[model samples]
Target: MTRNAAFKVALIGASGLLGRAIAKELAGVAGWTLVRTAHSRRDAQSVKLDIRDAAAIGDFIGRESPDAIVVAAAERRPDVCENDPALARALNVDALRFIANAARDRDAWVLSISTDYVFDGSAPPYSPDDPPSPVNAYGRSKLEGERALLESGAKACVLRLPLLYGPVLDWSESAVTSLTPAIVKSSAPLAPAAVMDAWAIRYPTFTPDVAVVIRQMLGRHARGETISGITQWSGDEPMTKFDIAQRIARVLKVDARLVAQRTPADSTPRPRDCHLDSVRLEALGIGRRTPFDSAIASVLARYPEPTQTLKSQ
Candidate 1:
């Protein structure tokens, strides 16, 4: 709470998973007035915003002139980006440059949310200092966005996150959303009996935990502190997708037969191991993270299980 010193905040993509979590966290906190905006899903309270439109973005920012702007919106699906490289560049690259430039003119610091996919998976446990080697269009576009922000000569922070799965608008909205058997339509997900990337490692971060760090970062800025440059906030536990699937079944009291299927080869080339190392974040005194398994049940409580599973006794 920056008590008695209120500041305006413009949160882009307030309707999405991580965006909604951040909105919820900042709702009643002192010294902050949230101006929510979402594309195609605007409610009565939130302003409708399409980042692709430069005039619209300029208009909104000019009207609000917020103290800080947090960009949680993105075209995140890898396959989707791969299919349409133009759309990917438009949303992930161009829109960010527009935002950064506009925010720079108004002297507002920007906090752009990024991902671990920015790195090539050949390495394990990436740090903030690691150079990005994006193999896919999605990663390439995001890496470009990072460069645009840093080069925009504006006060900006790039928080690169890892594979995210928490409460979602729809079951398929998030990659990790289908990990539970209740929502799975088949006896098992079309995965390999012996998971190919058994050695491939990753850190699955929970959204609310990320929101906590964002809030702290915002609070610090409100108190007149600087948070420039890149930071990594990942799950404490490092595990494979197979490991995650097994844990989801265990915690939800469902069958773990899904882990037995052969891993399906992805059409798009994925980084083999992009585990984000969070020692820098810890050293900087960021938020404490909940272990992946520990956070599973709580996230599960939000979404209703499928009425029935396809598998029969």
Candidate 2:
């Protein structure tokens, strides 16, 4: 199905960071109507549906009968998922299967948002074909979700994204507000642990740019394509966590001299690098990846502040 053709589209997780951005993109476009679902009646036109409730999802699909479904919701917090593995599995894996099945039953196209965590992060700038070796529970669950969807024999596209920063619909209750404050507060002179040698590269796309790419991919002719939604930052220079923190400070014009370097032994185990190579998307003429500096500026521009920063004890 093409964008020019009128079709009904259902977007799950419409209240999330990426979901909200996708919803905004869909709103301005023609030939598509946004069918939003929430855990509760958060807004008008939103149906009360939890992804864990497969029966409810099936019922909703039968009722709304959208031509396409975008599964952009997932339990994204790694620590939270580690604490509640069952709940995470129910929502991230099982729920995705249910949505894929429903879309298939209705002969609708499916586009599910995934994450770069599917990889173990041992390799830098992972391509779409890289073997997944997830080290964390959250990563494993998301990998399971991707496997379930692919194995279902449905026409689906799994787009794996990196750390996302974007403007939220409810600014007062947005992920950025909650996370950024903690990030800023935690920004202090690097401690022994803070300088840990752990490393991970993130594409960190702007919400607006990612939303535009998703719209183009779904509304255009890229069905059955498993694309990576990360930008190519130098194609070789992988940014470490310390590097990211330093850059964040620099973009905000804050004193980054105190941002110290540490080893992975001081903190939790994390992937050293997981930057994605978006050659496929670029080849398709979708959109180029936003520069790291440019993306940071965009995020900081949306949220300027003298907020309390979180300090790690």
Candidate 3:
């Protein structure tokens, strides 16, 4: 299908951090009819369709018969998924499986969003072909979600992502953004002291960059090209969470002190470092990777300055 064919596309989770970026990226682009859906936070502009509801998804797919479906919805928090495995599976795995099956039946394609947490974080810089050994419930559920979608025998692509940050309605929308307030809350605009896992490594991804990558992949798919199976995409630099926090403080011009603290001896077992090697996407010539600092600057530039600084805890 050419771009001029006016390809019908369904984008789930259009109100989310990444989803919102993707929606904006695709906006005003010719030859795409976007059908957006959300669960409870439905805006007047979006359709209310719970991904967990299989029958509703099936009905929606049948009615819309979109040429492609992009799944950006999931129960993404690790702690939340760890506490409620079933809900994670329902949202992360079952919903994707349902979409895959329905799209297959209609000869449509799927682009399912996945996470880098599929790895156990023991290894450094995982490749696209690496065997996934997720340590947490969220990772396991998402890995299964990937399996379900790819094994459904549909023309699908699973883009494994890293920790994402971007412009959002609030800082709580992304962990990276949530750390910003901690820095600027001091009376003297000093960066607040925030504890970070010194040993854990992460490659932060900007949502706008991810959106561009997805749009490129979708464009390829629309042009009857093969951009299927699993691929890794992330920012260029690899840094620890503490490093990320410090970078945030630097970019925001806050003198926040980011403490490099190791994970507690008795704390929950989380992946130490799941740095994804994004060579697959690079080889395919399909990503707009921005340097971490520049990306942070661009994202923070969008929002207003911080409000009255609150007393640090």
Candidate 4:
């Protein structure tokens, strides 16, 4: 089970939401050592390296000599990707290619965090074999990244997850939790109602749960298992932003003036419903779907805001 040898994992985005969660989960797990890396938000525990630089990635991997790698860094914002395709490709596609090739040289397993956006949300529940038709640059770039990693001939597994939320330094940390500040501001007297999208359906998976899943996958690999290929995990509860905001309001105990936009209204085209089938992972017994209500409540408690109402200023 490789218990006699030390297992080192290089976490490539230790400052981001999912990265932080993975770091925490792996911290307490016995027989796993973490070498964390960051780019924009460099920290003491992390070694700062530009993912866009192939040379830097190669050097870092050579020096660290980790047994496995977990990549969480990316240009995740859809709008940012939409506005700048080049930047998106550099970060999402090119950087991943660098890491994959480097890992292949070391014969190290690579688990890359991918998104459900690879599929245009047309089909109800897409399996790993389903065709990908990304609607936006973000999705397209990420899909390309998946290809780059798989094509590198590395011991790689692409774990695709849907919308994510967790404990945040700010409301804007997560698209799901970002609704909080808007809910709070709109709930104040004399403010316009917050408009939330109700057209697109999404499953907001929790990060810590995902972290646990990644750890389980790592353990499987340690015990001499084949883990390469595309795997997906997601929260089962489907809700749009409007549905999510309503739930957030309830959690905050506020009466937010929230308006529902029922039609497709995003400037960037998004899939109507991109529900990823987790049956594969379920069969392997490697996933967790935290109840959204309880999970969101935990997030709010950690980053609680001032209670607002319709009271006059």
TM-scores for every predicted model? 0.89, 0.81, 0.91, 0.95
In model 4, the Cα lDDT at residue 26 comes to 94
Please identify which of the two predictions, 3 or 4, would achieve the higher lDDT against the true structure.
Answer: 4
lDDT tens digits, residues 103-194, model 3?
Answer: 99988889999998999988778998989999889899999999999999888989999999877676777878777776566415444566
lDDT tens readout by residue for model 4, 1-313:
3656788899999888889889889988787789999887776778999999999999999999888899999999999999999999999999999999999998899999999999888777999999999999999999999999999999999999999998776678799988888898898999999999999999999999999999999989888885889999999999999999999999888899999999998788888899999988899888887899999998888445521111210
TM-score, predicted candidate 4 vs. hidden true structure = 0.95
**What's the number of clashes in each of the models?**
9, 15, 2, 0
> What TM-score does structure 3 among the candidates reach?
0.91
lDDT for model 1 comes to 0.80
Model 3: how far residue 307 lies from native, Å:
13
lDDT per residue (tens digit) for residues 75-183 in model 2:
8887778889998899889999998888788877777887777777776678888888987888899989988887776667788777776664333333333334434
Candidate 1, residues 148-176: lDDT per residue as tens digits? 99999988999999888776666665666
Q: List the residue pairs that clash in candidate 1.
A: 191-261, 191-262, 191-263, 192-261, 192-262, 192-263, 193-260, 193-261, 193-262
* Model 4 regions lying over 4 Å from their true place: 1-3, 304-313
Residue 113 lDDT in model 1?
94
Instruction: Tell me the spans in candidate 2 whose CA falls farther than 4 Å from its real position.
Output: 2-5, 168-198, 221-237, 265-268, 302-313
Residue 85, model 2, lDDT: 94
Q: What are the clashing pairs of model 3?
A: 191-255, 191-256
* Model 1, runs deviating above 4 Å: 1-5, 181-199, 260-264, 302-313
